[model samples]
Target: MARSKPATLKDVAALANVSRATAARALNSYGYVGDETAQKVQAAAGKLGYRGNRLAQALRSGQLPIVGCILGDIQNPFFARIAHDIEVLARECGYNLVIGSSEEELGQEVSLLASLRSLSIRGFIVAPTSADNNAHLQGLIAENVPLILIDRVAEGVDCDSVVVDNEGGAHKAVEYLIAMGHRRIGLLQDDMRIFTSRERMTGYRTALGAAGIAPDERMIAVSQSTVEHAVDATIRLFSQKTPPTALFTVDSLMTQGALLAFRSMGISIPHNVSLIGFDDFNLATFTDPQITVVSQPVSEIGRAAARLLFDRLSGKTDAPQKLRFETKLIVRGSVSRRG
Candidate 1:
């Protein structure tokens, strides 16, 4: 069925027996209008379901001095930190930061970009869903939009990016487990869509290779994209004939899921299953035996990304900048030395 056209200001005005300008003034409370006329216009608008377009109004006034921070997951504290930093920094430079979470979806990403572009968003910091953009990102580049990618970088798109050293962090964590005499170390990771996940997996493989430890296929748990999936993966890993003595998770949320699964299954940490999770969070130390994790500088990544965005907006750097922050291993009673 063909959808009916949206009601406009003119439609509301006609129903109220008033000029469009009078209807606009009454609806927006911009200028004086008689109480009776305002009520009539309001009633007409309500009946027709008319709503003024704020984006269009902003676009008409002038180029909006706003920066948009688009993220993959809103629930992740990592993204929340980045958004906070970007908003703080952008506001300092006389710009408002608008945030939109794409929920790690390609269609949502494209729609948000299109909508924000229409509003003349001055800059964009996006943790893209996938590297393949179908030319949507390339179009943004061609349009000369100031863009900075945070946490993830696209395949063919050449733009500014601020990311943590995923491989280095993973290697550091896994190597420490090996030093503690854990030979059967398991790698629990998400789907290799995002570059960060892939990099962490690479680091896992690199660490095992360098240590002369043979990679065991059964010990690896993958296809974990959500917390529930990660919980299931942990259960599957432990259900195996010969489970790994120590486990390394790729990200914070998944690590939490693993911890929960362990608790539910009555698997004691550092006793029955030594563990190392990625991205240290508030709950790390609150755990029974505290979690040892590979900690990335969340604040650093956000500030660096905002700086890159400001630089681009200010025409300071025409060339793209890829800044990789260092990650550290924080030992906090999570992994035990194998006897």
Candidate 2:
């Protein structure tokens, strides 16, 4: 059996009684066209099942129809949601999205960026893995690539960014614990080298200072880069003869590890000690003592990043902007009233 050829722009123009130039403008949204004529062209293309060659279109205008998204850990459900939102917005803006994960490794991040650049990705939305290894990103900026940072910011890289107020959220959550008389609250977080972790740690310290509670060195634990490692860290904290009455875990992975450790130690939530998590997810509400969490606006972050990238692509030659979204504390059954 012979396969039929794909539809072409000429076929659409002939069916719509319009010139190829008008059809191209109407379809690409580059130039103004009469509403009725544009509708006719669109309908004709749809009826003929026309799919334009993106490379051809780019050659015509020196513009690519693709953007790339890179993230530190795509396994995080929140990051997954962000990726989905970015993809939807890209499609709506007539650009395709390609995603890659760096796995929080500098080498992987560098390799992914190089590969995406070779693909002619016109813009990038990235959650950088390391603060120090930013020379590669600086190269991208020097080359005049449209870039937007998400979730985390790099050192000395001036670009548009979308991040939640980690400091405020952690401060509020810890202050609430302090108000409930949890003077011996412990903090468990990812490696302090990460920007978000640093901001969150500062917030936790600020809350303790505001309440006149001297922060304990032993209770302040960092250096865990994985969920399983966090389990051991939590155990070490609980093993202290005078342990904290409450625990605040930063990030979803560490929170999961801490919860698992509590279960293994036969500890009761809000009875033996209290718990609060950062970055809310479905499991937070479903836990036995529904977790109190600092919730980031995931969809808004994705949308804002998309808008920033588009602005850059549209020849907005202005100073880069940093957008910080606020986080909310969702009080649940995790904390107990200190009598």
Candidate 3:
């Protein structure tokens, strides 16, 4: 069987007995066209089923009615919620959202941004994978693209951003652990190249130092922010003869991993070891002992970032707004007094 070719604007113009320019004007409704000519163009387009190339039109207009979001890992519930909220707001603003997960890879982040940029996307909201190495982000800034940094910020990329007080949140959790007399504390964290990870690590060390407990490298475990990787890292950290009495995981996925690792090792929460984590998850409260966590305003971060980007898109010329929300320690049954 022979395949039929799709109809084009030229075919519609020829069928309507009008010039291509006049047909385009009538179809697109941009310029003056007689009422009869407009109706003829519409009827011809309907007959031929001709659809304008939206991508080409967007290129000619110098911007697309779409927003791109690059998140670290969409599997993480925190990032998932943010993506959802951003999508809602983008839709309300008459723009579509396109999300891509970098999976904590800087190269992947760069590539995703480049791909979206090629489409002339109107703006971007990114959770940068690396704190420092972000020349690609800098390129966006230099080009005056509406870019909003979410969850994490890249160094030297002066643009709107929405982040939590990671250091303060970690400090509060670790300080509470120290106050409970847990001197041997463990820190399960992500790659230090990540902005949030570095800040949380600093808080962990600060709390330890404040309590006069020497920082022990043996007590720390570095893992990718995933349940499986964190499980292995937690096992390695606790395999030592002198394991930490309590653990602080940087994010909820790692918290879940630590719980699994403890269960496999026959370690009971708040009995054999106490635990606290950054970012709250659905399973945090459903466990045998509800997990304590440093809870950020996850629901607000995405909306705020989207608002900033839309504001820029709407021609707001204010200085780059750096919005930092605070985190609160939601204490549960996860931690117990050491002494």
- TM match of model 2 to true structure: 0.85
TM-score of each: 0.81, 0.85, 0.91
Q: Give the better candidate number (1 or 2) by lDDT.
A: 2
lDDT (10s digit) by residue, model 1, range 7-96 = 888999999999999999998898899999999999999988888755566668656789888898777988998888888898899788
Model 2 score (lDDT): 0.89
Clashes of each: 0, 0, 0
Tens digit per residue, CA lDDT, model 2, 1-339: 432977789999999999999999899888889999999999999998899877777877666789999987778888899998899889999899989998878789899999988877799999888876799899989999989999999999999999999999999999999999889999998876578998899999999999999978989777465678889999999999998899999988888888998999998898998999999988987888899899999879998999899888889989999999999999999899785
Question: Considering every candidate listed, which one attains the maximal lDDT?
Answer: 3
For candidate 3, give the lDDT of residue 171: 97
**RMSD in angstroms, all models?**
7.6, 4.0, 2.4
Best by TM-score: 3
On lDDT, the stronger of 1 and 3 is: 3
| Candidate 1 segments whose C-alpha is farther than 4 A from its true place | 1-62, 223-225
TM-score of 1: 0.81
Off by over 4 Å in 2: 1-50, 59-62, 223-226
